[model samples]
Target: MTFFTPKKLPKAPLLVVIITLMGAFAPMSIDLYLPAFLQIQEGLATTDSEVKKTLTLFLVGLCIGMMFYGPLSDKYGRRNIILIGATIYSLTSIASTFIANIEGLQALRLIQAIGAGACMVVGRAVIRDVFKGKQVAVMMSVVQVIMMIAPLLAPLVGVMLLYVFDSWRALFWALTFFGSMAFFLTFFFLPETYKKEERPKITIGDTFYNYFLILKDRRSLGAMLGCALPSGITFAYVTGSSYLYQAKYGLTEFEFSILFGLNIVGVIVSALLNIVCLRRFNVLTLIIFGLCWMSISGIVMLLIGGQSLIGFFLSTFLLMCVSGFIGNNIVSQIIELNYDRAGAAMALNSSTQFFVGAIASLLVTHHQELLVPVMGISGILAVIAYAGLYQPWREVRASIEK
Candidate 1:
């Protein structure tokens, strides 16, 4: 039942466990320190923008690293890239604790993100490599549910840590511990799902050409953007939630964490529901459903307005609930489009998702009120996403169903 044991060999479930752990690193890195943003700002003697830049840099690092890791993993195989990235990730977390300035912290977070990026992109490729048909869909749902646990509870852990240490530095040390755990797990239990014969040759020109080829495909590119745009609003909320709840609403860290956790819990529930739905519905069908609900959630937020905290909580919860359904389904289809070059496909999906998210988060950080702007943009973006996909939904659906 357990994935991690000294002498136990890896199983199918164990691969899920390892990949899920890898996926959690980014969310945990983001969420665990959310409760400490203000404390970090004060301690490091930095402006709000500077403190926010740490998150932006982390996303940027993910973006850049995804591009690199995808091609490199294709060339080098999954296990070695994961191990190397884990080592880099762990070391950076330790180094992050020692940084005295905001700039150093930002730079180190970016490096940390680069390392963490390997697990996420490569993990997805591994899933595609190992599973087929509805099995892939279900396995992704399972991995998504498990991966989301860190975000669901990380803030609670962060709050508990703050209560004990009363310092932001505690988070980085905790990250170091997390990084080490993931590294050990990957090194010990994860087998190489990518075979040597299938590995792509290492060449810069070929990698860039592949990326260009990917972009030239209208359907794939459209789906990728359609999925990523509304998701940007989710990141906007992530970047702004602490400020929105704690500073604006006067909720304590514990209360804010509880509210924050609600969204993640919603995502988990939605993902599990998606697993049941996937047996009957195709990926594109679930995506359309997700987009519709996301738009509706955004509208609810706009009507509910900023003053209604319960309304904000309910609407935000609804908005996040759709993330799992849309992201996993659309991404699964994308992998199917280029299963042979899965690393590149996943890399493009993740890189664009976070890149767009980082920009949205950065914009939200500058605003005075988090609720209205975050919710408003989310609604508009959802509408835009729906519009983008509406034309191709039927075509994509038929293809996926077949």
Candidate 2:
């Protein structure tokens, strides 16, 4: 269990599978409740804006929880943190079932998101602790595949739950069940990837010092921002797409779900492409290429004026596929750059991405009538991130490595 002392790679394929499951926690939490949003609003007698705030709160909690879990895991161990977080998540998800008002539901969702965030941040950091470079990229691609499945299936599952129970609360009950299952799996099969002997001493000053060090490292910061801005773009799309599809495009929930699921197929295909590309190219190259594609897709979306479903799907699918590459590569680069403080690096990365996403989502939700502006603004952010963060990061890593 020594940090650098490998132990037969711990059944790598199986380990990858488990890690992918761990990584799916965030997507599951977000997507599972999506189809129920309108139902919940109606049931609670709240406005659309009020219901949207619940999503904002969940993201805020996710950011805060991600910031906390990384240092906690570095101090303790991965398995213990996973168990505690999963338990909290499960209990809070069940509590969500009993909430009567939008305010109460929002509170429970925030707690649930916090637990989900810990799972995601720690899971990524654990992978970094156990794997490196190309192997990490391969594993991340697999994780992307697993993560895509949640969004692909969540709405369908939510729709089915609606048919079965006619109540949105049943979705929370289902999440509780999923959380409980994840808890048992982690408790029994997830080993402590970070050994106590290898862990750095945990102290307030040391934590701040690590944060300062990471902030000072241009490559690390660049890679982090590269991931965060693109993530914000995706979050903007997620926040706005439902309204666009349902109200603007006049699609039914069933149709929208199918379209959403189809868009996720792009992620799966891109992940497969990433796995192949990682063997030949460095992570930074992959990230740049991905961002280029994302930029083009965003531009197309903006130009299309949000008029046609086909145009929307085409642009979004391309963007999501590109995201498959960016997601894993940026994280891989950051983890390599900040290997000594992998936990803190990952925590910071996750927190920043979620924070940016929350802000982007809020902006989109409030000003959704300006669809072009939302897409344009997010697209511009991606372009700035690519030019400012990713390009400079690649050059820096090359100079240092040489």
Off by over 4 Å in 2: 1-14, 390-402
- What is the C-alpha lDDT profile of model 2 across 322-374, one tens digit per residue? 77788787788788788878888888998888898898778877888655556
Q: Whole-model lDDT for model 2 versus the true structure?
A: 0.78
What does candidate 1's lDDT look like per residue over 1-402, in tens digits?
Answer: 124323443887777788898788789999999989989999999888788889988999999888899888777778877877888898999998888999999999999999999878888888887888767778888999998889989999999999899888889899999888887887777767777777776675676567777778766777678767775777778888778788878999899999888888888999999998987877777877887787777777777856577877887887778787888887877777677677888888889888888887778777646636665566567557545644655686678799
lDDT of 2 at 355: 93
| lDDT (C-alpha, whole model) for all candidates | 0.81, 0.78
Worst 10 residues of 2 by lDDT: 1-10
- Residue pairs with colliding backbones in model 2 are none
Question: What TM-score does structure 2 among the candidates reach?
Answer: 0.93
lDDT of 2 at 335: 80
Report, for all candidates in order, the number of backbone clashes: 0, 0
Tell me each candidate's TM-score.
0.92, 0.93
Off by over 4 Å in 1: 1-9, 379-390, 393-402
